[model samples]
Target: MAGGIEKLTALKVARLSKPGRYGDGKGLCLQITKTGVKSWVFRFERDGKERLMGLGPLHTVSLADAREKARVARASLIEGIDPLAKRHEAVASNKAEQASNLDFDTCVRLYIASREAEWKNPKHRQQWENSLKMHVSPHFGAIHARRIDTPLVLKALEPIWKTKTETASRIRERIERVLSWATTRGYREGDNPARWNGHLEELLSKPSKLKKVQHHPALPFAEIGDFFKAVKAEKGVGARALEFTILTACRTGEVLGALWHEVDLENRQWTIPPERMKASRPHRIPLVAATVALLKQQVGQDPTFVFPGAKQGKSISNMAMLMVLRRMKRDDLTVHGFRSTFRDWAAECTDYPSEMAELSLAHTVGTAVENAYRRSDLFERRRQLMQDWATWCSTPGVKPKTPIGSAEEVVS
Candidate 1:
């Protein structure tokens, strides 16, 4: 428009360009090429530096609109910003959409519906509904997803984080996930206000450090030596169940879901088929010496499970073992805490490799690339490690001391 742009004059820049783009003088110009294209270009010099930047082309854009764009760019330059930087800033700022007509309920419902089928278990769906009902829906469900900002998001999570840190952490994570979903689908915009990583970490205590989150209440690894002495002093189904858990490091649910077909005493392994695993993959748990000893002790038992319950095919209730602690007046500790107890002793008391420890816990080993190149599961190493873990736990008498070593909690 300023000079020679395919012979498009400043007076006719409006007529030549499209609805959304514009052109102006002062070396700022926008025009469609002979191929009916649209582009924004600015010709300018700053601090004795001259440069040209192509803004955009002119379909669905008008000449006057482009002139306004040029004015904004020039003003930004006067205020010590490069036009190119201003353009990127404008794009970023433009992401926050107006939400006068949006509703939070509909956004959450759609988010839940979109993800329901992908979740492996119904409890996943139930978790979504529970978070919404308990935390978000009560407050912001009536508001709009686009209207969700720092203060509103804080309101949704702060009360719960203050009182029930773990639940609040889940609710925050859930909201962040849902809001991210909405942003990609066009229901909202800007950075997620619910993100906890760099943003909310400043606002809230880490879930791991929070007392509510740490309350899985495990025995100190030092105390585990004494706990085993006490366990050997008493004998029953509950004691055996504790032995099985200590040997396998399996979740209470996974051990409960176990069946005779899954255990191969001959193979010395418990192949937890995919359906029983939280990860939905077949987990081959290498049987250690203690695990085999426990299974051999149960050989030819009438029940189908390696750890049998009073009922047929049902291993045992979670509460059955939990109640054991309650009866022993150690309700302060948890059944799942034994795994934490094992991890602590492995970390603080032994020279075991970190991968061996992780593999003993059945955790995925490395990064995707590293894992691709390193295919081995270190099965024998973990097998030996588990034997050592079980040996330490079931050790008869090491002068049983106070149950306190590595008091950190593990909640899975």
Candidate 2:
């Protein structure tokens, strides 16, 4: 005992089993809870009120360390500062720091959501999710965004870098974007670990050097008429959609996502909205008589979609045309390959200007400067081109003469 106060010794603290606070000299004490949990506390009075500050567990903090901490708390109280308030502020600051640090997967989702509106195609968002889930998520998803260093990103990319170069490149770009987003949002700091230009270029081979470009398998232009006939013989929304796709030389997604409102049967034109276009620009397709008749037949069946799916209020599956091809036993051909077939036929059989053929396919033609000077979409000339195409497609085994004039002269 010192100054009529019992000093808590290490031996006494270890032997004490009662659930009460046992005092030591200078306001330090050992607290034993009802559950037999033992911890150190620094007891003091400030502004005429007694306050107890938890130093730490008895097992972790030695008796000497607790006494030193008590001396510091007592000093703070003498200086008119509440030790409990100071401790609380420190704890809150640490919690705030932890709360601000987002994990990699969470950062990925936030980054995607922020840029969703800028993405032209709905599939682009899906592609981001699929790529990140397969490549980045398994390795670094749980790690704090700030802690994602170069080695971790390299580990995620190295396996796929050689085997799936294009996919690996896309994943690396996405990870870089997420990390950049985190840095800008204050969730992380430092140069992005996934940066490619000067940093990752040294680590991985150039994408161009590693990539082997593969084109879609297309049916020969001469065989398209026979294929069109086979598709026309089938019955269903998908069949009609497929036949319409061939007639217009449009992509599968374009035809399947078609809405009735976009069709102007009297004018013989179908105007695809900018959002639906692959180029992110509105496209006007000149429909021939055959296409107009097909639209008329499909009109009253569904009030919304030109090609309704099995589910209500939805467009047909993107796979619908492929399934039709499968049924026709043409497993080698893809629905998108028809556009290539159309391009081949225009080049080989017609005197149409190359620009018209490209425009009919809704492809962006010319450089930005050239496009700036060009104003017209040449809708009337395209109408004639499509009508001639319909005539050729309907009459199999017939070779047609060259058109009288070039597309530019015809349009003028």
Candidate 3:
């Protein structure tokens, strides 16, 4: 195997100082750079392309060591193998093996960090971390992500699957996502243990079957007029915000995150951007005179927020309206429940079309195809419906003259 190898000796290599390659035969050479720094190189031709593989510097790799490395490379070439490509494969394998040791908690943190920017809401991010810490982390937070199996995932979810099905379902989804991310990153392999399809579905009861649909406790539509009258008489920004929310039939977060910039008093409209909306689509609310008047009362409060919090520059706390309800001895009612009240009144007591009521509430009216054809938000019709609602809300003992069974009733 020697052939023309061992052409350069140790004593000759040490004395070689010119800025050029000195061949030691068999694709091995000593390289002297322009800066007088010395290194060993293995120059080989693969598929007619010459490639230089660095062995090491003169200070680290001795002449004998470089010879042994070159000999191995020649042996590999004889076997029709590229030593450089083999080294790269070995390095990648080592990295994957190290990544396999990444713990569940670490994976969760990394996954959340990677996706944090995409999640617009701080509360949503908090829910992810908090739910995992409270429910999942306790079970197998320290376990290696690759080792997490169906039984381990079940251990975390079984206790809550029946008692807190919704939360358990969310945790299961989060775990599946993390495991999927780990798999993609080469930290884990195989199917996701937390998957709810054919895998976990056979083990755990369906979330829908385990949990009953729980509606927010709402005030009866008949009592909303009296409730609205009483709430109007109550003090603070919360009461006014609550009044505006009811009149607009908006969600709690939509009302709380309301900025003065979103409201156009001249146009009698409030535009909520897509990021803040539940459906991730922009919504336009047709404001009634009652809502406009209520908002006007709040003009001097804060420059940014429509309903300013006690602290400067922040919007009102999410619990502010609920606290107002508590103060009014209406602990049984939720701020969200007002939307149901409005929907009921629109369905049972009005001559307005159901689509008008749905549009006023900022709800999707029909299928995607139907919505594409029905381009209009029905703003003009919604405005009239909202005005009637506001007038009824302001009237304490007012009854719906157009009952569901009456001749004047048009809504079904």
Candidate 4:
């Protein structure tokens, strides 16, 4: 409270020309910059550091206003609070409150914008936007995203939950993500009503219960050789992709997304990177002679994608393999079914251990304790099993004679 005498009048402040701190009284001063602009400042000491809090421009904040602000700031200093820090908190609180009023559509846009880069597939962004637009936005697009509750979410989901179970599930998940983003961004508060584990589970029947479990139609193990013959007879990138998929027993995405760089011809192996895999872990495949031959046929001098599409620098469409199956009039089987066929063939006709076969399919197997001890991928053992499978597929009428080795011998 001790400072310069109250020497500043409105007229004196208005006419002041000196470009320096002009004290009024009790830590209040008029600051004139070298550019001739004037403002008010309240000087205080906090934790041994001198701090200046801006009151406002002299043109807008009158002498009386500046004095009152300085009084409040001094009072806060006595209370051991930094008045400038308190003002910052107030501004931030106001901004958060304003942002919380953003409607569902706007929040969706912001959430997508913030997270689009992290999504692996560009099509995933389109799927999110389309699902929200088709199912959610029509009901709650204009409602404040924070204001949405269980009833509002149910309103968007109930009509389709039973009828379009898959689509409804996707919409519910997307809503949960957007609401979660909103809450984390300080735009919303409380539990996310869109969550399924405990909240929506009570409201809606389980998706599995609503819709019958539909497995991908698979080729029977005994008929794999015939299917392999038909797939090999066809030509084009799609056909090659399908044949490679069957040979490797990999997921369709892994085969189609394959690049020449991932293939090591010398090692007879294909390494699928973690990002493109379903388990999000790197999987190594032991390529057989036939698979290596197939890769040699598909390889070009400077290829980006092993299975190039109609568009330059792009992989084949996700539906390309399915169309191949359709064109061959084998609509009874799915492209993914080949994995099951390989699994069956390994289990029944070969002397390979189940662990080796599972590893061949890139599946996580064994108990946690067992896996902890099983550090190796059993890559060499799997190479022989895959070789036997490739030989069986290529030779039409020969039943695979089990190799003369016990599971223990091969695994050890």
User: Cα RMSD (Å) per model?
Assistant: 13.7, 4.4, 5.2, 6.1
lDDT of 2 at 270: 95
lDDT of 2 by residue, 254-281 (tens): 8988999999988889999999888888
Clashes of 3: 0
In terms of lDDT, model 4 sits at 0.87
Candidate 3, 103-189: lDDT as tens digits: 999999999999987786887789999999999998999999988999999999999999999999999999999999999998888
Model 1 scores a TM of 0.62
For each of the candidates, give the backbone clash count.
20, 0, 0, 0
Q: Which digits, one per residue and each the tens of the lDDT, describe model 1 over residues 149-209? A: 8788888888877678877877888888878988888888799999977898888778777
- Specify the highest-lDDT model's number: 3
Tens digit per residue, CA lDDT, model 4, 47-126 = 89999999999789999999999999989888988999999999998987786699999999999999886777788889
* Candidate 2: segments with Cα more than 4 A from true spot: 1-68, 75-89, 119-126, 207-211, 366-375, 400-404
User: What TM-scores do the predictions have?
Assistant: 0.62, 0.79, 0.77, 0.74
lDDT of each: 0.71, 0.88, 0.89, 0.87
TM accuracy, model 2: 0.79
- Give the lDDT ranking, best first: 3, 2, 4, 1
How far out, in Å, is residue 400 in model 3? 2.6
- Model 3 residue runs over 4 Å out of place are 1-89, 96-103, 142-144, 183-188, 403-412
